[model samples]
Target: MALQNEKNNRYLLRDWKPENPTFWENKGKHIARRNLWISVSCLLLAFCVWMLFSAVTVNLNKIGFNFTTDQLFL
Candidate 1:
């Protein structure tokens, strides 16, 4: 299967440098800022997710279980 391998192969970009110097200098900076903000928002959103466990764990500890390292991790 050389033919099969070629068909299944994915071209991976290990080196990625955007072209268009003027775009990078001027327009690209604004676009890059927008993308950066979007990325940060996504990251913060992801962290906000699954935080219910923290609140629930705190409530549970108030009832009985203490906020042990295990509870914090869980």
Candidate 2:
């Protein structure tokens, strides 16, 4: 048996049987959905950060930075 860290409410699950329809209907679906949303949220956050940098770089000239190509690349 796996020992759970009760103080943190973290479980070391000994087994996972999400393939069982009863389990899937009751718990697996919720777990799966939560994981999917978490992944999507992370992807969106990453994309936003990437776009922010791209936008900043594109507007450097318009903002009158007077930076060289090598400087901007830095």
Give the alpha carbon lDDT tens digit for every residue of 11-65 in model 2: 3334467989998898778777888999999999999999999889978999878
Give each model's clash number: 0, 0
- Candidate 1 wrongly placed segments (more than 4 Å): 1-17, 57-74
Regions of model 2 farther than 4 Å from truth: 1-14
lDDT string for model 1 (3-69, tens) is: 7877776543233345978656766676667779999999888777757666776688678776787
Q: What's the lDDT for candidate 1?
A: 0.69
Best of the candidates, lDDT: 2
Alpha carbon RMSD to native, model 2: 3.8
TM-score of each: 0.44, 0.66
> 24 in model 1: Cα distance from truth in Å?
0.6
How many Å off is the CA of 42 in candidate 2?
Answer: 1.9
TM-score for model 2? 0.66
* Local accuracy by lDDT, each model: 0.69, 0.79
